[model samples]
Target: MSGWLPVAPCTPRDCAGHRGARRGPLPAAVLLVAGSALTLLGVLCVPAVQLLGAAHRDRLIRRWAYTVVRAFGVRVLVTGERAEHSAGELVVANHISWLDIPLVAAVLPGRMLGKREIRGWPVLGPLASLGGTLFIERERLRALPDAVHAVAQALRSGSRVVVFPEGTTRCGRGPGGRFGPAVFQAAIDAGATVRPVRVSYRSTRRGPVGVDGAPTGPCGGPSADHSGHTGAVAFVGDDPLAASLWRVVTAAGLTAEIRLLPLIPADREPGRRALARAAQNAVASDSAKRPAVSVHQ
Candidate 1:
């Protein structure tokens, strides 16, 4: 049992199929179903997340969300140093696998901002909404104003709003994966602090990479990398609620790392791309240092 734990970095074969292979070897399909069911249950409970009560309840929702999928046998390893966060911050992260949902949720103690499609998901979406998730539809310029307003309101109202400003996920070592400027404008308008987060997946079950960096299926977002021992990976925009959930269950084996960078706040009345660049640099640098699949994708 102790051997399953990671001591430090080694070759691809070292950690392959050891931890996941253990546990009496359940079928991948079985684990997938189990994980999916737990997630569905969490979704069904979304309403309770909102109705329940205080910040503590919200934290419970996020933690439980992470736990439900974790039952599938995916290990999450959080690395890099976390930056100090001030009140009313807007956290931005490089979107990757669906495992990212919990990775970021684990670190943030505030409301999450997701795409509108999420609100329509079977059970998970509702749970997310009830859990104080802010939903915005893509390419809706008209709605951008409202979305910004909601984010501002959330921040001023004493609730932090975490936004994945790349707008969607993508595959790249770069911090830019197709960013949306409207949200940045919103932050400037609201005078909120922006923090960047980078999410990555390294295998513990398969060899090096889990899958290719190229997206798979109708990936609602970024597809996790798959390198049977090759160390390949895939990053995409955002996945439909279902596919994201499946990534965890079907993963041959892997560890997810979510690194939080220093928060960049809106001080002056107007902030520029420079500020955004600053935040991006912080996130990219720290994220690059963390281990996983290829840094190339």
Candidate 2:
């Protein structure tokens, strides 16, 4: 791997932990089938969806993405105010699971900036290509500038470009990895606004009771509980796609919360490094009190 390519230390054995609370084999099997069917349906409908006007297309994309997440038995709780839809905005979020892709699209449907490898995934590859994903060669240091230029062109052409600036998936237990500055340069190049979104996973099942007999917040760490189900959603180092998919389908009551922070104007930032830092800080700051959870099916 190139020295510039970002790599996360998390692995399935150490960070993913146990399988946690799972649905019965039958129910899990059903969920897996449904999720796969939905994904294939999306792939089939791409041509028809492209024929619709931009406004209508976006609505369908959002609804389809939301249903896909629901089909996998994951509940979504979106907090924080979402910025009004506009052209040339950069949507950046912390990477954890493959679910993050559709999760973000459900709320903010846009052209995704993904690893070049995703272009070869089974059902998702064609859909990503038809949906206008920008693929970058993450392992080649020489490709960095060209990738940034491609993103800049997309933004300049009035497309909302979604990216995972962390460069790779993390375990989502704590602050995972730093946002790379390279992608931020595209925002600066196009004078686009940067929207930092934070993604966190939690098991809906309550943890162990405290000394006072009330359920305590997350057993031993910031997220996940005794079951370790929430952490299992993470697709980290060396975890096969098939295994991760099975884990997601079997896990019970897995909830993904997306926090949308205020937007930062790229022009106002001194440079890409500073912009990356500001966005990272905004995402890392989870100081706000928990709002009433609104489950999006």
Candidate 3:
């Protein structure tokens, strides 16, 4: 990591490895122990989900997510109103960082549609699986149909599903990927309402610090302008998880904002593309209002 990582022992004020602590490994060690305990417990409970029931299990998962967020010392900010707890509702949001997952999980506990790669991570993989995340293999075009059906079935069963239609993470300051139309079909088939959410990250520092290890340059990406803001909160292209995690822990006074806009009712007649465009428009409009954070090249 280009930035300094605090390797010190956990203290009353620095247990979460916030910036400017005497560097050492003890703080990370503390978080690792706690995270491992939670992950193991989640994995062990996977088989008992049927007995515990989805709702109860969801509560547990949400609590776990909430704890994980606190362990990182990042603040979650809320804006606008949340959708009613109705069946077949799809929550679509812009993806900016790995933090977005747990942040959303803490707010709206439910099954998430994640990329297949997440299933292979050491601790996070098992925890996410145990939490009932549906993994989609982005490279396997043939499997997409089944994935859509699975999401629709979950919606039909009244399970709220969260999706990052951007397909990949973006720097919080720039335009996120346009929504893919495939996921919207699930809403059409299951008659689910689409909730478009805009997620953004702000740092305690000023100046455009690059997240991708690139130097500040006017040519491209988040470093395009030396806006004197830190991209430490961003988890964009080619950035390793460890580096991102380190950056997050050391970023003092970082906050993530989740704005849940009015829900869009699913069309009675099937129109996946139309629905996708509408949701995309809603998200893009709100996202544009935030300060532009360019993606690091």
Candidate 4:
């Protein structure tokens, strides 16, 4: 085991362990204490954190969040070069995992909308608030105006903004893998071009099959994952945070691949289901079409 691991198991178990070391620790005590402290402090500094302009604050918060995610060991693999979009353009992509934030932030390097709970997280929360991320509490519904404003303000300020219209992770299965039409309103409201991106993780591209990961293709998989329970980084808006974090902490490093495509004009914005279908295709298309893994896998 020792000798093989040193060689890099190229297997999920080893990959998971590497991820644990990167994310920090696996025990609840560590996360609990750290998370609790941060939560408390974020509340205390709420007023001060809100002082910066949304873009300025979220820039800082995103940096902090990306760092923390990196420290946990989730490496982002981006492909199909990211094109510059006008300030009001909305960057849309599939929601694959919770770690999507750091994974995307590492390269996309922009402001995004997060769940309300993320806004309430301790040091990280305030840091995010300051970084210009708009944290929305869906249950409250009334907060939609504020959330929209934050996104609008960011774009209006000439900063790029992003949204995950899937509204949740596919968990790699079934109907909802497609993006919901309701979520599309944000980009329309902002009058932004729709730049679609694709994302996926594979067990191996150069390695063997023993460590099978989710298989994706130009049109999503002909393959299937019947074990359809949510993955560690549940992208679904409703998964419990504690459980989600636990899964992410315990999982191995993901070979994330992102393909950023051209900006579609409002006149060209694909209808409800088509938008997600386009992205889904893009994610796999980029990977399958690659002559080589151009970006780090």
Candidate 5:
């Protein structure tokens, strides 16, 4: 790995814990089948979806992304306002699981900024390529400028670009990795508005407690204990993709919450470093006021 590439301290052994409640083998198998089928369906539709108008295509993509997450038995709860459908906005969120990709796209369907290695993954690689993902070479610091330029060009062409500036996945229970400043330059260069989103996971189960020993509630309600469920979805260092997928399907009452924060005008920020810091701080702040949850299509 390159020195510039951001790495989280979390490992599968330490960060990913066994949940107290899990679905039976049969139910988990069914969920796995359904999630796989939905993903393949999205892949097949990509070609046709590309021919549609931008607004129509985005609507279809948003619907497909929402379904994919739900197919894995994960409830999607979105709070705060999404950025306007108009382009030239950069959507930045905390990195937790592979599910974060679809979770973010479910609300703000846009061109994704992903690591270059993901372009070679099994089913998702082709789907991401067809969906217009911008891949960056995280291992090569020399390629950073070119990657930023590509993202800036996309933004300038009136496209909403979504990026996880943390560079790698982190367990969601604690204060996770900081946002890397490089990608923020693309937003500044293109004069795009930065929309910071906070992504967190909570469980509806009663028995499993959080890392801090907070009590959990029953199904369909809020729980102070989120660590157990959050671990079920976390994709951290040295964790196999298959293991993560299995955990997600087997976990019960898992909910992914997306909190969209206020937008920061890139032009107003002193530079990319300040822009990155502002967005990170906005996402890190926990709101005391409860916001109305938006239904995911």
Candidate 6:
């Protein structure tokens, strides 16, 4: 394995497939069956996530996430090592698809800070709250101070909090606006370690699962990108959540790439702004030699 790099830039064309024309929804029969199965799984797992203790909760969360990703037919490609988080450590990552939540959770398994809107998202809302997500009303400026304080306290108490500093979803093709410096104060206040991460998605092709429940293809693997790669899972703009869900379920070879950079010691920075700049630069710089792909031997 290689050491983490400060910069990793992605090409704009990498996100082209996501913005392409909508292909409509999947077959109603397939959608109905899949939706029912997923809802049943969610209902069964939410209680375990809530009633269990920390270690058990995190393990269950990881298993739930892994099952859901595979159910959606999404493949993950990770770059860099899984962070060994210290108490009060802050994880900052770029936001792309709603899929980013489970993908990141699958690897990091921490409490997340999400916009208030997610709290009302049907079955997901209740599960998220039970799973320890902290909800914030980002639009209410007056509430910002208190929220930051609460986050800081959580950090100080030895909780791992994941925050998407961009404040809104953006294409993974490139970095969005500067990382909002407001939340960095939490890291500074708690003297927490700050870690930056980058996530990107791409598409490829493979044959459908067969009666034997085995993936079959010419080489029994993803086809070359040049042959066929469809962005069946990009969520941006006003794209409806339902549309993105349909895309992910029906498409083959959808992959999410997550790159975790080196961690920054909070005390080394003079203030939150300086720390924020360093963290942003660490995630924004596309200087990593090449992203390492996870492949089964």
TM-score of each: 0.71, 0.90, 0.76, 0.60, 0.90, 0.78
Among all windows of 10 consecutive residues in model 4, the one with the lowest summed lDDT is 3-12
Clash totals, every prediction: 27, 0, 12, 18, 0, 6
**Global lDDT of model 1:** 0.56
Kindly report which residue stretches of model 2 are placed more than 4 angstroms away from their true locations once superposed.
Answer: 1-3, 18-20, 206-223, 226-229, 288-294
Cα-based lDDT for every prediction: 0.56, 0.81, 0.67, 0.51, 0.81, 0.66
Could you give candidate 2's per-residue lDDT for residues 1-297 as a string of tens digits? 543567887767666643345576799889999999999999999999999998999999999999999999899888887557878999999998999999999888999998888899889999999999999888888899999999999999999999999888888866668899988999999989999888887775544321211222222242245543366588888989888888788777788888877789998789999999999988877573247445674
Q: Candidate 3: worst 10 consecutive residues by lDDT?
A: 1-10
Q: Which is better, 2 or 3, measured by TM-score? A: 2
Q: How many angstroms is residue 111 displaced in model 6 relative to the true structure, after the best TM-score fit?
A: 1.2
Off by over 4 Å in 1: 1-26, 51-55, 82-85, 172-175, 205-247, 268-272, 286-297
In model 5, where do residues sit more than 4 Å from their true spots?
1-3, 206-229, 288-290
Native-referenced Cα lDDT, model 2 = 0.81
Clashing residue pairs found in predicted model 5: none
Off by over 4 Å in 4: 1-70, 140-150, 174-176, 205-243, 270-293
Q: Give the C-alpha miss distance for residue 4 in model 4, angstroms.
A: 48
Better of 1 and 3 by TM-score: 3
* lDDT tens digits, residue span 109-174, model 5: 999998888899988999999999998887888899999999999999999999988888877765
Q: Name the lDDT value of residue 136 in candidate 4.
A: 75
When 3 and 4 are scored with lDDT, the better candidate is 3
Ranking by lDDT: 2, 5, 3, 6, 1, 4
- On TM-score, the stronger of 1 and 2 is 2
In model 3, where do residues sit more than 4 Å from their true spots? 1-41, 44-50, 53-55, 206-230, 268-270, 287-297
Better of 2 and 6 by lDDT: 2
